[model samples]
Target: MIVFMGTPEFSVPILKMLIEEKYNVGLVVTQPDRLVGRKKILTPSLVKQVALENNIEVFQPENLRRNYQYIIDLKPSLIITASYGQILPKELLEKIPAVNIHGSLLPKYRGGAPIQYALFNGDDKTGITLMEMVYKMDAGDMIEKSEIEIDSNDDYGSLSEKLSIVGSNLLKKRLPDILSNNYTKTPQNEEEVTFAFTLKYSDEALDFNQTSKWNHQRIKGLSPNIGAHLIIDNVVVKVFKSQLSDIIDIKPHEIKIENKRLFIGCSDKAIEILELQQAGKKRLSTKDYLNGQNLFINGGMTNE
Candidate 1:
C-alpha cells in the first residue's frame, strides 16, 4: 500500500496517477486547515479534496506523532511525498524509504519554495527530482531527475503549473522501479546547496534603486501570486509584467507615461510596464489605466 503525503494543487496529479495505475494508496496525509485572506475563510487543501473524491482514507495531522501514528500502524509498503510541507521524523523514515517528488533538479534548489525562487533568481532551467527521503532537508540520494527550461518571460505561476504536470508523468514512469528495488542517489554537494526558504510580503515590494535587471528577477520570482508592488502616492501598485531598459537618467520611485506605455526610468535601469493593478482596481494595460482615471500621480522622471 502506498501512503501519499501532500497538501497543494500540485500534488493532486501524482495522487491521481497512482490510483489510475491501480496502486494501493493506503491513506492520504495532509496538513490541517487554517484561516486565509481577509475573510478568514477556512479552506481544505486541494490534495485533501482529491483524496476524499477517491474515497481514500485521509489524515489531517496537527502533530506527526499524535495524529499520524495510526498510519504508521498500518505499515504501508511505501510513502510518497510531493509538496508536503512538514518534515518527516526519523522514526517515520525507519518504517519506510519515503520517495519525494521535488520540483527542482536535485543537488540544486532544495526547499518548499523552489519554483518561485527559481523564476525570481532567473534560473535558465529547473526540473523535477525524484529522491529517497532521508533525514536532513532534501539531502537524500536522487532516484531520477528531468530538466525544463524557463522562458525569458516565464513567471512562477506558469512555470509551476508546467513542472507539476511533468512531475506527475515522471512519477508514473519511475514508480515500478522505486517500488521494486533500491536505486542509487547522488549526494548533493553542500557547497552547491541553495534555498527558496519561505517568501514574505516584504520580499514582494520592488526597489527601483536596484538595477532593472535585478528588479526583473524580483518581480518574476513573485509573479502570478504574491506579486511585486510599488508605492505610488500612498497607493500600492502591483507590477505584473515588466522588462529592463538602458535609460540611466531616471530617478527611483518615479512613474512616467510615454507613447501609451508606463516607463519608470531609473538610475541605471528603466522598467517598461506591460501590465499592472492598482490597489482596488482591476489589472489593465497602461493605456487603459490612463483612460480610467483623470487624476494620476506623475512622479518626477528627473533624479533631482
Candidate 2:
C-alpha cells in the first residue's frame, strides 16, 4: 500500500493520477485547512479535496513530527510525497522508503520554492526530479528526472502548472520500477547544489534601480500571487505583467503615460506596464486605468 503525503495544488495532480491508475493508496496526509483572505474563511487544501472525493483516508496533522504514528499504522509499502509542506522526521524516514516528486532538477533549486526561483533567475530549462526522501530537506539521491523547457513567456503560475503535470507523469512512469526495487539511485553532487528558499514579503517590492530585464523578471516571477510591488504617488501598486521598453532617457522610478499606456523608468531601460493592481482596487490594464483616473507623470516612484 502507498501512503501519499502532499499539500497544495501542485500535489493534486500526482494524487489524482495515482487514483486514476488504480494504485493502492492507503491514506493521504495533507496540511490542515488554512484561514484565508480578509474574510478568514477556512479553505481545504487541493490535495485534501481530491482525497475526499476519491474516498481515501485523509489525515491533516498540525505537526507531522509528533503525529506520524498514524501513518506508521497504515503499513505503507511505499511513501510518496509531492510538495508536502513539512519535513518528515528522521525516525519516519528510517522506517520506510519515502520518495519525493520535486519541481526542479536536483542539486539546483532544492528547497520549498523552486518554481519561483527558476523564473526569477531566468533559467532556460527546469524539470522534475524523483528522489529518495532524506531527513535533511531535499538533499536526496535522485532516482529519475525528466526535463522541461522554461519558455520565454512562462510566468510563475503557468510554469508551476506545467511542472506539476510533468512531475505527475514522471512519477507515474517510474512507479512500477520503484515499487519493484529495481531503480538506480544517483547521489546529488554537493558542489553544484543551490537552494531556493522561501520568499519573504520584502521580496515582493520591485527595485527600479536594477536593469529593466531584471525588473521585468521580478514582475512575472511573482505574478498573480505575491505580485512585484512598487510605490506610485505614495500608493503601492502591484505589477502583474510588464515588458522591457527601449526608452532609457528618464530617471529611475519615473512614471510616464504615452498613448494611454503606462511606462516606468529603470536603470538600463523603461518597463511598459501591461497589467497592474492598485491597493484596494481590482487589477486593470493601462488603458482602463487611464480612462478612470489621471496619473502624475511628474512624480517619481518611491522604492520603499
Candidate 3:
C-alpha cells in the first residue's frame, strides 16, 4: 500500500491523482491544523481537507522525527511525499521505499521553498522532479522530470498552482514504473546543486535600494500570501502587487504620488505599487487607496 504524505494546496492535486488512478493509498499524512488570521480560527491544511472528503484515513504528527513508529508499523510498500513540511526520519526511510514529487528540477532549488525562489530570482522556467527520497533534503536519485516555463507575470500563487498540477500529472505518468519497481534512478550532479531555503521574517521586507526589477521580483515572489512590505512612517505597508514604472527622477527609497498612482523609487527606476495594505487596513488598489488617504505626501522610507 502507498502512504501519501503532503500538506498545503500544492499537494492536494497530487494526493487526488493517486486516488483517481486507483492506487492503494492506505493513509494520508499531513501537517497539523493551526490557528490562522486575526480571529485565530483553527484550520486544516488543504491536503487534509481533500483526504477527509475522499474517505481516507488521516494522520497529523507534531514531530514526525520522534513519533514515526506508527507509520513503520503499517508497513506501507511506499511513502510518497510532496511539500510535507518535515524531513522524514532516517529510521523510517531505511524501513520503507519512499519518493517525493518535488516542485523544481532536481539538484536545483532543493529545499522547503523552491516555488517562491523561482519567482524571486526571476527565473524564466522551472519544473517538477519525481525522485527517490533519502535521508538528505531533496538529494535523491531522479526518476522522472517535466519542465514548465515560468510566465513573466506568474507570482507565487499562480506558479505554485501550475507546478502542483504538473507534479500530479508527472506522478501519475510514472506510477506504473514506480510500483512495479521497474524504473531507473539517475544520480544528481553535486556540482549543479543549489538550495532554496524557507523564507524568514526578514526576507519579507522589501529594499527599494535594489533595482526596480529586483524589487518587482520580490513582490511577485511573496504575493497572495506573505506580502513584501515597506516600513514607512514607522508603519508596515504590505505590497501585494507591483509593476515597473518609467519614473526615474525620484531618489531611492523615496515615494512619488502622481495622477492617482503610487510609485516607489529603486536603484534603476521606480515600481508602481498596484496593490497594497496599510497596518490594520484591508488591502486596496493604489487608485482606491489614493482616493481616500494622503498618508504618503512627501517622505523617503528607510531600509530598516
Candidate 4:
C-alpha cells in the first residue's frame, strides 16, 4: 500500500495520475482546511478534494510530527509527497522509505518556494526532481530529474501548471521502478545548492530603482497570483502583466500615459503595463483602465 501526502493544486495532478494508473494508494494525507480569500470562507485543499472524489481515505493532522502514528498504522509500503506543506517527523523519515516530487532541479532552488524562486531569479529552465525524502528540507538524494524550458512569456501561474504536468508524467514513469528497488539514486553536490525560501506579502512589492529587466522579471514571477505591487495615488496597485519598453529618460517610479497606454519608469527603461488591479477593484487591461480616466504627461505617480 502507498500513502500520498500533498497539498495545493500542484499536487492534484500526481494524485489523479496515481489513481488512474491503479496504484494501491491506501491514504491521502494533506494539510487541514483553512479560511481563504477575502470572504474568509473555509476551503479544502485541492489534494483533499481529489482524494474524496476518488473515495480514498484522507487524513489531516495539525502537527504531523506528533500525530503521525495513524499514518504508520496505515502500513504504507511507500510514502510519497508532492508539495506537502509540512516536513515529516525525523522518526517517520528514519522508519519509512519516502520520496518527494520537488518542483525544481535538485541542489538548486531546494526549498518550499522553488517554482516562484525560479521565476523570480529569471531562470531559463526549471524542472522536477524525484528524490529520497531525508529529514532536512529537500536535501534528499535524487532518483530522477526532468527538464522543462521557461518560456519568455511564462509567468508563475503558467509555469507552475506546466511543471505540475511534467512532474506527474515523470512520477508515473519512474514510480514502479522506484517501488521495486530498480532505480538509481544520485547524491546531490552540496556546493551547488541554492535555497528558495517561502515568500511573504512584503516580497510582492516592486522596486523601480532596479532595471526594467529586473522589474519585468519580478512582475512575471509573481503574476496572476500574489502580483507584483506598487503604490499609485495612495492606492496599492497589483501589476499582473508588463513588457519592457524602449522609452527611457524618466525617473524611476515615474508614471507615463501615452495613447491610452500605461507605462512606468525604472532605472534603465520603462515597462508598459498590460494588466493591473487597483486596491479593492477588479483587474483590467491598461486600455480598459485608461478608458475610464484621463491623465496628463506631467502628472506623476507616487511609489509611496
The numbered model that scores best in lDDT is 3
Against the true structure, what is every candidate's RMSD?
3.2, 1.8, 1.2, 2.1
Residue runs of model 4 more than 4 Å from their true location after superposition = 293-304
lDDT minimum window of 10 residues, candidate 2: 294-303
Best by TM-score: 3
Task: List candidate 2 stretches off by more than 4 Å.
Answer: 294-300
* TM-score of structure candidate 4: 0.93
Better of 2 and 3 by lDDT: 3
Q: What lDDT tens digits, residue by residue, belong to model 2 across residues 25-70?
A: 9899999999976478999999999999999989999999998987
Q: Give the higher-TM-score candidate: 1 or 3.
A: 3
Residue 59 Cα positional deviation in candidate 1, in Å, after optimal superposition: 2.1
TM-score of candidate 1 relative to the true fold: 0.87
- Write model 3 residue lDDT over 9-66, tens digit each, in one string: 8999999899998899989999999898767899999999999998999999999999
Q: Flag clash pairs in model 2.
A: none
Each prediction's Cα lDDT score?
Answer: 0.81, 0.89, 0.92, 0.88
The digit string of per-residue lDDT tens for model 1 on 1-304 reads 8999999877988888898888999899998987865467998888899889889998888887655568779988999999988888888998776889999987778888898788777789999999889888888888889899999878877787788888999999888888887456677778888877766677777777777877788878777656788876667778777888666667765666666777775557588877778887788876788777632445322211
Each candidate's TM vs. the true structure?
0.87, 0.94, 0.97, 0.93
